[model samples]
Target: MSDINISKLDAASADFDRKLQKLLAWNEADDRHIQQTVLDIIADVRTKGDKAVIDYTNRFDQRHISAAGELELPGEILKSAWESLPAEQAQALQIAAKRIRAYAERQKIESWQYTEVDGTLLGQKITPLDRAGLYVPGGKAAYPSSVLMNAVPAKVAGVGELIMVVPAPKGETNQLVLAAAYLAGVDRAFAVGGAQAIAALAYGTETIPAVAKIVGPGNIYVATAKKFVFGRVGIDMIAGPSEILIICDGGTNADWIAMDLFSQAEHDENAQAILISQDESFLKAVEQSIHKLLPQMERARIISASLSARGALIKVNNLNEAVDIANIIAPEHLELSVEDPEILGKNIRHAGAIFMGRYTAEVIGDYCAGPNHVLPTSGTARFSSPLGVYDFQKRSSLINCSQTGAETLGKTASLLARGESLTAHARSAEYRLKA
Candidate 1:
């Protein structure tokens, strides 16, 4: 096997920032053709409802379903899938589900209010959506983890019903995914996928019900459909490629860091894996380890391609500089593989999820760890956050004003409304004031 070449940069170099930016750039240009195609699909689903969904599902997923009813999987099938799983697999799923549910339970928001001096009540009310859609990718890979991550949180937030849609290309379904759906307490499961499934979820079909919000990950078509139907129904953030940034102190095992980088790199050609360390010798050791390990990976070609395209091994002057670079990247997954990971983690303001300590592999968080693996990518961690129960629950401002409080608030509202030249708003507030 040949040596793998990865990008290397010195943080003290004059053009380090530019080089880093070039490496970090991920342009998700909206392909006009995809947008138009998704638009057509959405419009068709809206106009024809069940027929459009069935036709698209047949064409795209290569299925031969004659009726809309066939698209909806029987809940019994999910249970059977769960029951049929091997004892080991079933036990693993159960354990992961329990941990995820426990974490989500803590994230659930409760309604709270406080009384003011005038006995006016003011606070926020938290409510879950009536129904939510979870889109799990189905063609090449099966993501049972996606099922648990999206569904458990919604359930914890007290969402009334959770609907799941996974494409069954060639009329074949993954047992693990169905088992996960059953385990996660999905209210309904659909066998259709792609933009058609998204459209059906956004606008109710004869068999499928429209949901208040949609979550999960998908391909370009699914993402474009989500973007088109944003205002019509709430959606989780549009995700980018998976990413991992590891900051090492040149003390951890070189092979461990190499495998950690490969964990994200093997995701896809676009997935990124980077390492920042102060030890030049350690960086070389990791590079050697990459060459030694790449050949053994099942997806070696993919990992190699990803590392060549987006991966980096940087030499920083110190750990602080490493943290500074990490802040700029705001990666989806940041691993502090140093001795004092907590201290370094304290200064981290951005990053979707931080895995502290050498033993804390990012892969653990992807699976059984108590946090949601669905996270903001493409530098969005700077503002966005990981998928959690909070995403499933929404807040409404609560206000119950006493007569005196209304009079006092009315004066302020009247002035603000009048300043904006909204006579109706001004009069509406003035009407609530004491005569």
Candidate 2:
């Protein structure tokens, strides 16, 4: 009772719920405009093919390009860009790429068709896509990491061809990004981006070949395009703003937690970084840490806005209460930086990924760790999963019924089809069972 009394539990439950409904949430209306644009762009690209892509590139990119073939990013640019990366940046990219590739390779699954207990051979054949589109976002932030996170998995999953479409805004693609793409062993790289690039990938353009699936993070525009084109082509997930949730108690230091929160907040103004603490004193300390740390950051304005607007330093009744809040949030990244993080980590059911202990940082997982950084956001973690080698893979059910097995399965199928009032389905099953 004494501990709970000190927390911020005043008559603000309704207000908090309203804020929660607004923040830590995604807006459907915002995507409608983007969807319309993507649909029009997809239609234009489909009708005009390469010409439409080139025209959109020139119009949107402000480039002086005339033909779609001209929009095909030159190989020499990647070659020179790869050669020009500073030794340190180049080495860092290689190290991260290696780690991502190794992790993704491990996630690759093989097909398995096995005999069931009922004498029925039922299994799925895991196969890779014929081609996949990888969207690497370059606006607001340069995510060379996005390149490896999205493409390496496809490579490991044995996707036949991996094409990259990066929205190089202002007619620019960073050298480090190109280097990352090169090192990741991308099959094709194009300069066109945004909803337009998604259109080219979803529908074939003469210059840009179509892909069976698209993966990676992007702006809302890119996410909307992915959502609109899902039926025509597969997408990894509609990633929203970056999100991180940290749970702490009395034993943890506030400064480290505050810094971790800032890392995600700095990514964008809409990004969410939350700290759930059992101790009111601990929460205050973290607030101070945030104040102390904000002065030194280069992106302090963006971080401050995100924290004051959407970031939460929640004071819960106990560790269990903290865990409950975290489960509801289903944050993209979850960290347990308590005295016994491993013990507390077991309570978490819905998170894209979990980082345990004070020594483990979210940035570690973002860079060199053996897990994926591409994760579900905006509570999608409740049902979805992180981007993995499986995203680029396809599955085919293997069905080969022996004479006896066919008789049994055919009878069951006929019964189900008849129950569902599908005479054609029942007749097909009857034919299989016929003498």
lDDT of each: 0.95, 0.81
Candidate 2 ranges with C-alpha deviation above 4 Å: 1-23, 28-35, 116-120, 432-435
Task: Score every model by TM-score.
Answer: 0.98, 0.92
Q: What is the lDDT of residue 361 in candidate 1?
A: 96
Point to the candidate with the largest lDDT. 1
Q: Pick out the ten consecutive residues of candidate 2 with the lowest summed lDDT.
A: 1-10
Candidate 1 ranges beyond 4 A from true positions: 1-3
lDDT of 2 by residue, 259-324 (tens): 999899888777888888878788888888888888888988888777766787776768887888
lDDT score of residue 260 within candidate 1 = 100
In model 1, what is the error at residue 56, expressed in angstroms? 0.9
lDDT of 1: 0.95
Over all chains combined, what TM-score does candidate 2 have?
0.92
Global fold similarity of model 1 (TM-score): 0.98
